[model samples]
Structure formats: structure tokens, C-alpha cells
Target: MTPFEWILAVCIAIMAATLLSGLVLVLRTSDVLARAVLADLIFYTMICIFLTWTLTNPTSIGYEVALLAAIAGGVLPTLSMARIISRGRR
Candidate 1:
């Protein structure tokens, strides 16, 4: 494999490990806010994995999906935070 491919592979492996650890944290946390934060971490990690895969195999369709997913990943967390805040106020 080329250097770039090797680097991407390493990054993917590290991200996978991080994702697993985040899952554990999410499961262990009793607080709603904490779980939300951890779930967001997991979501971002999955997006990273998808982007990395797309890097190795460039395709227009996949790129568009990845872009949309990344955008949604950002937006969902904000909505979740808003919901959490609104519920907390009550």
C-alpha cells in the first residue's frame, strides 16, 4: 500500500478504537447530558470513518452522501442540545 493509504488505515484504526471507547462511556453514563455528549462523539467518529473511506475510493455519489451526513452530524447535535436545555428548564 502507498504511504497515504497506510496513513488513512492507521487513522481509521485509531478512530475505531475511540468509537468503541465512546460507546462504553455512553453506556456507563447515567446523566442525560453526558450521554448526549458521548453519543455526539460517536456520531462524529462514524463520519470520520466514512470520510476516510471515501478518500481512498473517490466517487461523486459517495462524496455527496458523506457531505450530507457530515452536515447532519453537525446539526443534530445542536438540536439535541436545544432539546436537552429546554427539558432541563422545566
Candidate 2:
């Protein structure tokens, strides 16, 4: 395998480990705020996985989806975290 492929594999392995650990944290934690944060981390980790996958298997629409995910992922989760923290207060 090429050096670039080797690097990508290593990155993907790390991301997968992160994804698993984040899931475990979300499951085991009792704090709602920490759960919310972990949820956001998991979301971004999935996005990173998608982005990394595209590196090995290029697709015409992959980048577009990644862009959309990047945008919506940020806004929706931030809003959710704020609302959760405030208990729905303005």
C-alpha cells in the first residue's frame, strides 16, 4: 500500500476507536450535559469518518454531503445543547 493509504488507514482506525469510546461514554455517563457533548462529538466523528472514506473512494456527491453535514451538524447540535442546558428557556 502507498504511504498515503497507510496514513489514512491509521487515521480511520483512530477515529473508529474514538467513535466507540464516545458511545460508551454516552451510555455510561449520568450527566445530561456530558451526554449532549458526547453526542456532538460522535456526530463529528461520523462526519470525519465519511470525509476520510471519501479519500479512499472518491465520489461526485460525497463532498457536497460532507459540506451539508458540516453546516447542519454545527447549528442543530449547538441549539440542542443550549436548549438542554437552559431547560428550554430563552
What is the number of backbone collisions in each predicted candidate, taken in the order shown? 0, 0
Poorly placed runs, candidate 1 (over 4 Å): 88-90
Candidate 1 C-alpha lDDT tens digits along 1-90: 999999999999999999999999988889998888888889889888888989888877887877788689878789878899688564
Q: Which candidate is the best by lDDT?
A: 2
Error of 2 at 64 (Å): 1.3
Local accuracy by lDDT, each model: 0.88, 0.93
lDDT of each residue in 1-90, candidate 2, tens digit only? 889989999999999999999999999999999999999999999999889989989899998988899788978898999999998999
Task: Candidate 1: count the clashes.
Answer: 0
lDDT: worst 10-residue window of model 2: 70-79
